[model samples]
Target chain A: GDSVTQTEGLVTLTEGLPVMLNCTYQTIYSNPFLFWYVQHLNESPRLLLKSFTDNKRTEHQGFHATLHKSSSSFHLQKSSAQLSDSALYYCAENAYKVIFGKGTHLHVLP
Target chain B: NAGVIQTPRHKVTGKGQEATLWCEPISGHSAVFWYRQTIVQGLEFLTYFRNQAPIDDSGMPKERFSAQMPNQSHSTLKIQSTQPQDSAVYLCASSLDGDSNERLFFGHGTKLSVL
Candidate 1:
């Protein structure tokens, strides 16, 4: 079975500092699609970024993630954390089905 | 568009009772997906329908769970003999197709509690 692993269960960063959420996955399918979804409090989870091509950086709403098949990782990163960036982040891998990580709660302090 | 619409934002059922959740996808969308969310398990895919036909139900638990897309506009997920373990938020989403890169439009989800 395919699975996604998100190492950080919680992340806290001061505003203006860089932030990263680690995501890794295991699957036998080639051309796997990776996705980042953000769930704000009381809101539905929405797509933030998705990548199907290896080594290509996908950016959305000032956040970016690059898929690296060599490392089986697609880490979400932002140059500077914003107060509004605090949310639950989910990393997913899509093959014939979609596999999601447990998610990481991000908190940005002003 | 109104995005995805799921009815009965919240539901409560007695143990062993039946529960049915409904979802209306974005118009013209060809793919519909159902997922379960919980504090411990996070998000889990349950089933999906492409063009009103079920494509994959591998994630669905046998015996108690069933899903149907009678038409292109809506789908239903029914659980018979609900249990405490079945208490979770059920989310429904729609996409343009079954393509891996297609962006999914998600409904707010229906939170179900079984006592």
Candidate 2:
């Protein structure tokens, strides 16, 4: 079975600091797609970034993630976190169906 | 486009009762997906339909959960004998196609509460 894992249940950081959300997946499919989605309070989840090419970095809205087929991971990272960056982040593995992780609640403290 | 549309923004049902959630996918979209979101589960896939055909429903519960795409315009997810554990935000999403890279457009979701 395919699955995705997000190690951190919650991540809190001060404004202007760096942020990283760990994501890993396991699947039998050879060509897999990975995605990061962000959901704010009272809003629908929106795509932040996605990658299908192994080892290539995909970025959006100041956040970036590189798909590493060797490690089976696609970790989301941002150099400097902003207060507005606080949201729920989900890591998903896309095959015929998308499998999502438990999600990481990012709280950027000002 | 109006994005994905889900009717009855909220639904409340008693235990042992039945509940149905409606979703209207974006025009011209070929794939419709149903997901359940909870504080504990975060988000979980329920089922999906492509071109009005059931593609994959492995994520659905063996019993009590059923989904149907009677036509290209809309889909419905029905839960028989709803229980307290069934309470969650039911989200419907659609994409231009079932391609892995395509972005999914999600609806506001229908909040189902069972007591």
Among the numbered candidates, top TM-score falls to 2
> Evaluated with DockQ, which candidate comes out highest?
1
Q: Stretches of candidate 1 above 4 Å error?
A: none
Return the lDDT, model 1, position B69. 100
**Which tens-of-lDDT digit does each residue in A1-110 have in candidate 1?**
99999965679889999989999999999888999999999999999999999888989899999999999999999999999999999999998777789889999999
What are the chain B TM-scores of all models? Answer: 0.98, 0.98
Pick by lDDT: which candidate is best? 1
Candidate 2, residues B40-65: lDDT per residue as tens digits? 88889989999999999988997999
- TM-score for chain A in each prediction: 0.97, 0.97
Docking class of 1: high
Relative to the true structure, how large is the alpha-carbon lDDT of every model?
0.93, 0.93
Report the C-alpha lDDT of model 2 over A1-110, residue by residue, as the tens digit.
Answer: 99999966789999999999999999999889999999999888988989999889888989999999999999999999999999999999997688899899999999
Query: Which lDDT tens digits does candidate 1 get at residues B1-115?
Result: 9999998899999999999999999999999999999878889999999999999999899899999999999999999999999999999999987788787889999999999
